[model samples]
Target: MEQAKDLLAKGVLKPGDYAYHEGLSDWTPLLEVIVANSEPEASPTPSVGPSLSTAPTPKAKSNATLVVGIVVGLMVLGGLAAAGGWYFFLRDEPMELVKTTPPLKVNVPPNKEVEKILAREIGIWKITGHRLPVIDPETGGPGKAEDIRDTIETRWKEKGKSTVSTFSPVINGKKVSFVGYKEYDAKDGVFIWRVKGEGLPETVSKERYDPVTKTFHGEVNYQNNTRELSTFRRINKDRVHFKSKLFDADNKLLGTSEMLFTRLEKKEPDQPPMTAGSLTAKEAAEVMAWVIGKWETKGKGMPVGGEPQAIEITMEARWKEEGKSVEFKYTMEEGGKTVSYFGHQQYDEARGIFINRSKWGDNPETTSHERYDPATRTSRAQSMPVSPAVGSKTTTVTKRIGQDKTQQTLEVYQDGQLVYSHEIVSTRIGRYVEPARPEPAPHAPQNGLVAYYPFNGNARDEAGHGHDGTVIGARLTADRHDRADSAYQFKLGDHIRIKGLMGKPKNVTLAAWVKLNGQQGRSGADIISIGTSVNIRVDSKSGTGGSSRTGRGSWLGTNAKVNYTDTGWHQIVFTFNDNTDRQVVYVDGTSMAASRNQIPIFYEGRETDTVVGINGRERNAGFETQGVIDDIRVYDRTLSAAEVKALFHSE
Candidate 1:
């Protein structure tokens, strides 16, 4: 484009050479095209010498230019004609046109049978009952049974989304109010009962309704070791029969309550009435989801006339595989010792069978498989332990009483005679929390390092187990290596308080390096104390007085004479063995005297578990360490004497 413009500007158009404008298809003689486009007042061309090329007369140039223009315009019009013809008329075939159809609609409604059950239960009921078998604290015999009245009000709301039931029971001049929601859980493929109220632990009940019998039943589990077998029967549209039997974890029947409820009122539901329907084959076949929660046996009551005191076991069930199966865990803490186990709980829907397969510590694996008879609402399981192979097969049968509760019995047979029996009436109590994912690497792989406060300036849990200590009145000091502020120093009221982590029954080892000032009376000062804000106060009183050891009403230990006040850094360890039933004291990794505790030295699972450097004293009076302490580590499992020594020397 620049070259063409330059040629035109310089009067360089050749007479016989062709010229063309943008958009023109045909080219015209240069002299003719220039003459037609030249301005009227532009300078006339100067004549060239004989060697220059020239054109014909101006008139002849005009005619040739006109001819070229006509040809170009014709070509342009022809191209436009073809493009427009193809776009408007040539792309389609001569076929018939059709219109779009609307999408199909299918009916997906709620279960008809379930809706019918809910409708029948939508009324207020008033009941009266009695609590039985209360123990007499003074006479050591049966006490007067307590009588009570309860009001159960149920209503359906939010257009059939759920049924709400409120339970208000008047007992011993106290009114207990609880609200429960009964709804179908889509994720679990079953109906669930959840209730919450003041002073009541969270409870959940799994319900089943039998249409033929017009009855509903459920097992209700309280999070705090209590469960009950409850049944509901609609005698007529005007009344319902309700019965519940309460039991503790040790399978001791606490009492029974039977209530004949009269319908007080009913509210009509709005709109196209909800219908009832049955569950799918898959939902009816599986029970694992209904059991997904924490379950505990109430540690109350016992064998009417025997020892073996009530043993409470807390079990947790968590689901996996889209609720097809669960992983179960349990812990039992009794007699200063705790036992824990982990297992997989799975169900085979096709075979109407479920299994609880568990393994603990170095113990053998025990697998219990249960076959359910749906018609009788009962299941029987045979458990076999391999490894330390207890060859005896134990059979357990669970009878689901109503929609909400179950009763289970275990019989251990040895050589054809029943050697042992364990029974429990458990219920679903609470949902499981998602377990935390552990860090890829642990700080130290040393055996049983549950909590480690290195005190490298601040009390941080280097073990990454999250049990960090709070330095109450300690100041950072220099260590032997002259590492500034690596250890802690306490003077007068200076101390540290570590939250109690010894809730469960386990052998524990608390080891730390300490250096105390050789001051008078500082001899018996506490190095550490474990307790709640109130109970389980393990005042490490000096190894001196019997009163400190016995009747101080605290589990007291002391430098009684280990002489930590020598003004030199020494290793101190507290080795508590729930199994051995004693708390041993060690100085510089050497064992001192041992003491038998009134109760095993386990802590309440609560805050204020341990107070360091002070003996039950937060202020002025009690013994406080005037010393330096470092390298505090706590373990959940017991360490042998050799292991404790190794831990100290490892520093």
Candidate 2:
């Protein structure tokens, strides 16, 4: 007590400090105890100590109650003080507290979590292997399916914080037909994948990733009609394995597919493929782009049960599966009927070969495998009958001769012996351009010239033979030389009637300068024709020139290989020598078609009016030229090959 009084007097002991002893019920501040025990004592220096009175301070009747109240009040006060003190202390030494305190676990932001997973997917991935469940007919159970190739590209978007994925499947190797996005919902604490594709319903899947196993699991809902469970396991930085199991509405397992993805190294666009195994569908499609067009094919071969004969085949090819494959339609006129066949060709990346499939009516399908040589722009193909009972086989070699031409040689074998062969030439029905050539000087051969219509702003016969023509429904247009109103543009129902022209002559030559608009009607567009006597027209099917007796079908006409019905200016000439009963057709100074010992036109000697731009008998029908005509000429005698060349050069 003496030591405590001395310490209190020197201000070393604070009032809030508690004092305890064995007799005390609980800790009590010394200030309250001292004030309770002491009386007021007068001193010379009253300010140096707390005020004291000789009489004792009034106390509660229940000392125990007072002690309890004081203790509770002190505890409450201490808690507030301690809290305030810790706040300041933490502000001063935050790292020290963190090092000593137990840490709390919290979730990362949803967007951040999404970024963590997709970052591994940002690159090109190829389907190196695939397996599908197939039904076995013999056992009525599941069997293994073959593998195929596909490509997928995942890239970063939205400032590199988000990712979007795109896929180019084998069905359409040239286009990105499938697109997908990955998103996260913070409120739901889930990841979602929304996928859409061409001809496919949009699919949504909720997914979760397990970092422990480096795997992602998803439950997919396809427009509420089907469901699938998918798993993707990341084997390493460059490989992933994916499996999907499809279920029916009743929760029955229907099928399962598995794929192995491997990262692909980027290559330059112009670089050739390193190997056949690494060829992409897009690259293969590019190599075949030149084949998309209409083509006219001509060849001669002996049929299996028929005599040898000339064959004319018209083929049209176009893009299918968004350019992954080329689809073809072929038509051949035989025995007054058209025989049609449908086929398609596509690249098989797995086998490094081209597959061609064809079907003819109800016949079984025929499949062929081809190997391509990029350096020579050629493909070699071999085909065998599906049934081993048939020993017939075919081998073909197709080569690209030019931008507008190709040549194919086909050989057939039966029982290891050569049975027949054919060489077919295909010509594209258009020109690169009509090269501008200087017109020959106005010195055409005049020995056999009988009538001429220069069409130089008028339809009068320039030869001055009084074979003037009257234009109807035809309009003047620019000539091939770009001279205004020097040519005539013909449309449906448009024609020019000429008087005194369709007489029977011993030998005759018909020539004209033409510019075709495009393809014309089925019966072909007439450049000049008479009533069932003679005609020169564009063969609509082949886009070439044809000459024959008027009203004769295409089978009876003499068609040329030169496609005069191209999108450019051309000069066409037809010459006939009645003595030899030989006829020749020329386009742009080259002989394209010839015939001998055929029935001559106008043999019955009919003198019908000559009509230009449409057949005289089918006026106003769909057989109009659909083209422009200029510089028409008629000769009473056969024009020599040189004479025809001179006429073409005369422009």
Candidate 3:
């Protein structure tokens, strides 16, 4: 109690002071502190020192203690202040206290889900027709179908010499003549013929009837050749059908076309066909199996004349195939280097036909069919017609039978005349042997540019100045090192700058041999500017605003430097990278220190226009350094440091 009273007397308890509570650390009101203090004082007062009367005045002791208490309290408050500042202001707050919501979930649909699958069904048919019907004169109607059979046979005999056979028939009260012709030569000396009569319109005009014409049109075989000439009759104005027989020159029956046609209804425009599936690994293996094994080809197209020549063509069908279909590639040595051509056959089991497409050299579309022939142990195929523009020729392709079955021969015919023949011998090896990769050409410098000068030694400037005249005399040195500029100078009045070459340029390099003798000790002049009229300056003094000098050493000249020297021959190369932040200039392959300036200073006097030996004013004012110039070139790419050095020292 005494100690408590002494502490209280010293004014240590502030208004917010309270007894320490176990649960809550917050300061209680001073009233709570006073009540807690009073209770402690009433509880105990031990009667202690009687000899303490002689002790120094208790006031001095109390004052001294009060001072000490105040000091201690101040120190504690200062420490609390420092700690509070650090926790709330200086230090980072707890990350958990920060109110941050989780990232919003983005729902990306699957690629397949986003794509709309469209379904289509394609119907194909092989039509064959071999019969005809009779006609009634009185009713103008078709007679018994059986009776016309004899008439058709008789007409064929009468027109056997000519290519066409005709029959007169009545249909729907109209007299119509059905005409048919044979348009192809068969191996048996027979040609396929078609007959159209009554109700049938003449689809094959005389212009398209001859064998030469049919061949020119790209018909595959005698059967198709005849069918192409057959005409269809419009039945009920909604349906059309045609029937014809294919016969050889000897009038022997070969094939027929009994085609049925229906008018296509107007529908939505067709979308590009999508591939349904690709060849499986097993199917690929099977396809390659037939191609595996060494084979040789004979016949005219083979290397040796009509003799089996040793040739090797390896077939590789793998991911390298284009699009969705697998490709059968045949690579073999022709002449000296290995040349490769591919026969891409897509087998649509559902369609029952293997569509074989091939390309050789630069030939146009040549196609064929692959039909399995068990007897020959090969596929019988025929080449599609070649364009008449391709020398009025037709090429026939035959895949021969053999254990390897990889050899094929091609025969080209022009107007029924045999032309050239080629043979392709392919083999299938068990192991996949990758084709040899050709050695790569030396890598060109990334910043290098090359210019080819095609002009003769006689080129003139726009101002009608020739090589020996003022234009060339004013710009070139006495010794013409750069051959391109030695004999030519583009004059001012020429008004046209024809690039010696023809092509679009992505990056450009400009080079020239210059000898500037015009006006000395000036700055801010220009020799050539590419982009805009006011984009480039040759020489000029710094701080010269508008109204700068036009020639060498004008305001355009920076740092009092004469990029256009009036002395000897010097090669100047300027490279511009349209893609970068800087342009470079090389004076004999050595880079010059220059300020970063925008390309093509555009202005009447600012050196923006393409000028040679002078500024835009057409004034040659500088020191007039005279020298012969030659060999000016330009490149489409920037030159590397090494390339610039090479150009400078190039003889």
- Candidate 3 residue lDDT tens string, 263-301: 232221211121123344445345545453333333234
**Whole-model lDDT, model 3:** 0.33
Candidate number of the best lDDT? 2
**Please, what is the TM-score per model?**
0.29, 0.31, 0.26
Off by over 4 Å in 1: 1-445, 500-505, 518-523, 532-552, 556-560, 596-598, 602-607, 616-620
C-alpha lDDT score of every prediction, in listed order: 0.49, 0.57, 0.33
TM-score of 2: 0.31
Tens-digit per-residue lDDT, 1-651, candidate 1: 334334534545323233445343233333334344433222222111111011222222232222221111111001111011001101111211111111112122257655765666676666544333323223435433444344555666332556755443332234433445566654544456554433323334554555565655445443334444545567888776554444455655544444456667676321111122223446533566666778765433334344545657788877544455666667787458775555666665444456566655445556665666666767667665543322244677777877546787776644334556767777656777865432322332367777676666456567776665666557667665556557888876777776554343356666777777745233355655544222111123445211122223344443335354665777677766667766766665567666665445424333445666675445424466677777776676667777766665666
**In TM-score terms, which candidate is top?**
2
**Alpha carbon lDDT at 288, candidate 2:** 61
Summarize candidate 2's per-residue lDDT along 91-184 as a digit string, tens digits. Answer: 1111111111111122434565567666777666676443333232223344334444566656543312555554434331232234555655
Worst 10 residues of 2 by lDDT: 76-85
